[model samples]
Target: MVNDMDNIAGTLQQSLIQIITSVLTVIGVFILMLTISWKLTIIALVTIPLSILVVAFVAPTSQRLFGRQQAALGKINDQVEETYAAHTIVRTFNKEEDEEKEFNRRNHQYYQSAWKAQFFSSLMMPMMIFIRNVGYLVVAVVGAIQVIHGQITLGNVQAFLQYTNQFSQPIAQIANLSNTIQQTIASAERIFEVLDEPEMDDKIKETPVLAGKNLPKVEFKDIQFSYTDEPLIQDFNLKAPRDKMVAIVGPTSAGKTTIINLLERFYDPQGGHVYLDGQDIGSMTRDDLRKHIAIVLQDTWLFTGTIFENIKYGNENASDEEVYHAAKMARADAFIRELPDGYQTVPDESASNISQGQRQLLTIARAFLADPEILILDEATSSVDTRTEVLIQEAMNALQQERTSFVVAHRLSTIRKADQIVVVNHGKIIETGNHESLMNQKGFYAALYNSQFAGN
Candidate 1:
């Protein structure tokens, strides 16, 4: 998508000047031909209509093929990216041949579209050349007869013939540029499609309602949402009291992460409002809402940058000392310092140089440094060792002090002490209470909790 847009931009920029020069040249040469002999000038004009018809015939087909070509290229890029990004999984599963075959399929699709688009675009120049030559032949034969009848001079006829070629030259130049114009149009359509999408409302409401003194720090009010036509999280309501830890535990696809996504305003509920400090989150700018919240996701993402820089991304204005302190709090400083470059260590593109647990720790440190009023940890300790989990839990316990926290955990053991343990299935909360209370009730939460320790 990006490369195609760049090519479109370059084509447009170059085409603008070429098109203008060609038009002016055509106009100037036409006047000269008229001055030499109006009869020959009229003969030359016949090619203009023919050139228009050729473009009319070919432009749509060329544009359509180019669109398909760009689409195929996008698929190829996606396949290559997905393959390389998951190369480890592919090798482990012995599915390298499957991946290669998929890549070849996408590559072949690209080849098919590209050749057809090129073929149609290439036809424009030859067709224009053919029309120009026919016009030249007609003008020459007529000019010869007129010169012999003494109605027009041989010198004038010769000059008119030369002018005819000049006129045809610019026309052919413009015809060749039709291919580029078609490509640009195709690329521009893709770009514009994105640009034309309805923008999210960033307007902050005046007279914003403040959270009631007794209200929860974060609340989902009668929320209704769905990823598809099937309803999910219908009439879902939850509240996290100020300065409390709320743990959401569920099986896979139980909409645990979806709850976090809602709280962070990643997706607005289709049917209800989310409140922050009693104010409708929809009324606040996304930046404002996000500033008060920080999330550490299951997947650790580290760009190609120094360890210190990645941590400081949490708070760009944070001092070096503050960054180091945050890392220590998240239990990431020890591993970071042991590295060859210490804080200056630049992780590779995938950040595979460091261990997965280290990457998660760094993300934790980043969230800690944000010092947000609301902290979200989605499987933050999933990648860490048992010992590292203990240290991170301790740091998180301290970090959650006097701040609202949401922890999405798969391991039942992790949220034993949470103020509120919400057991979710599908999307609705099936059980809500402290772990001790739920275990005593011997409900779904108790069964799920007990199953984990069944072997032990």
Candidate 2:
């Protein structure tokens, strides 16, 4: 695709025009040649199909080579993205040599594929020229003989030579345009391939009003799911009130995040249902469903913008005072004010101006500004300092006072006071209770908590 971008934009449209103009020129010149001499015109027309045959033979090969070149270029881009994104870890682990070798290998592969594609495309012109000139030589020789015998005029012979050049000129132009056309085809196919893919179901049902005291704010009943063919969550069941914090805890890749993904409708369960405020999540528009929720992820993201702008992202209508208040609640105000530009400083991809913890603070402040009806904290405090984490927790406590909240935490201390702590392992909820009750049960949660505190 990148390869296509480099070549397609500059020539595709122009080459299409060239092809049309050249074909018209060929036809007009052919008619003029016939008025001068039919014999010479026939001679010139004979080599054209040979040129067309050469073009036909090389086209499929050129297309195949271009495909390989694009694939290799995509791989090169992928490697570069991975290596640069993990630059710190790569340097720390001293894997520079291995990374460089991998990049060079991909670069070489791209070079090989590109070389072949260009070579095949490049073959068309010279072959057409050779065939055209051969016809040119034959015409000049035959016309010379005819002229000497007074069978044709010398003026006519000269005109025939010029007409012969004009006739083959369009064919030569076609050879050049062929390269652009092939690449444009390849690029267009790639683009439309993505466009042709199936999209998620996106029908919005008419939201019905509910009047019930027993409504589950969020519920997963008999949920069955998996990224692959196998079932991960065969019969999962969970229910939480409209105003409380429910924490999901588990080992890495033990399907804790998957639960949040399902509730958020990132992926729907193969069986059973996820409900929000007594309505099936699948039946609601994803945009409408997500509007009431705000998620603060472990990996914070801030675009190129001022601290004030970043804080106001979730609630673009928020006032300056509201942004300031949110920042203070998330304990980000102190550091933000200390910066050289204060709230006006921009932090972007470079990531050099602000620390990771500060970035997390900004995201938290943004979420706070939104004042969502439902909140999701995915290891939200993992980047901040212990003191900052406590402050953020306090802010979360205030936010959850009247809204539903789900917390995915690795640190047991972070969720000790959670209304419910569900211990997950092997894709199943092995235990559920508050901290003290789970400790009393001495079940999976107890074992996990004990392991974290072990040898302390």
lDDT of each: 0.88, 0.85
Tens-place lDDT digits, model 1, residues 158-242: 8888888889998899889988888888888988899999886566656467644698898888888989999878778899999
lDDT (tens digit, per residue) of candidate 2 on 335-367: 999999999998866667898778887888888
Compute the lDDT for candidate 1.
Answer: 0.88
Alpha carbon deviation, residue 366, candidate 2 (Å):
1.4
User: Candidate 1, 349: how far from true, in Å?
Assistant: 0.5
- Identify the leading candidate in terms of lDDT: 1
Clash pairs, model 2 backbone: none
Clashes of each: 2, 0
